[model samples]
Target: MENSQNQKQYWKENIRLLFILLSIWFLVSFGAGILWVEELNAIRLGGFKLGFWFAQQGSIYVFVILIFIYVKLMNKLDKKYGYDD
Candidate 1:
């Protein structure tokens, strides 16, 4: 029973992490790229419009970075739950 409860808690935390990460990805990809493109376009980055950059390369870069962050967070979570082996 205790093991089952532990598993439930672990799964809950994992889902929470996934939700948070995915929300960030969605906000960056959809919000900045599409919704706020005009506002972002007013700013320049590396000779490119910030909005265009986010639409093209920025989201991809952020996704990759988020992947790394998720991995690191999951590692810590695993250790916390005694699943790091």
Candidate 2:
């Protein structure tokens, strides 16, 4: 039925968006927060240290902002892809 096809398209779009969002999340959190922490630590943002901020707070804020950005972008993408309901 048309409904089932629409549901499948929705799921596909969601999966694609999820992967992209999670990849960015991992890169910012793990890569910037842990792996490259030392190099980043040398850099400073105002009074707070870069590495510490990324690990403790910055990554989380980035993730939240990214979620909103993803939603906005995905909505536009879905419309362009003809996947919007």
Candidate 3:
């Protein structure tokens, strides 16, 4: 019973983290890439429009960084829950 409860808590934390991470990903990819594009386009990045940069390259870069951040966060959470592997 205790073990089951621990498992539930671990999963809940894991899912919460996942949602937070994905939300950031969406905001960067969709919100920055499309929604606020025009406003972003007013800014320039190395001769390229900021909006275009995010749509083409910035979002992907952020996503890749997010992957490593997710891994690091999960590892810490796992250790905290005594579920390290």
Per-residue lDDT of model 3, residues 2-55, tens digit only = 999999999999999999999999988999899998999999999889998999
lDDT of each: 0.95, 0.87, 0.95
State the lDDT of candidate 2 residue by residue for 3-79, as single tens digits. 78877887787788889889889988998899999999999999877988899999999999998998898898778
Q: Pick the candidate with the highest lDDT.
A: 3
- TM-score head-to-head 1 vs 2, winner: 1
Cα RMSDs, all models: 1.2, 3.1, 1.1
Among all windows of 10 consecutive residues in model 2, the one with the lowest summed lDDT is 75-84
Error of 2 at 20 (Å): 4.3
Misplaced by over 4 Å in model 3 are: none
Question: TM-score of the candidate numbered 2?
Answer: 0.69
- For model 1 the local lDDT of residue 43 reads 98
Worst 10-residue lDDT window, candidate 1: 76-85
TM-score for candidate 1, residues paired by index: 0.90
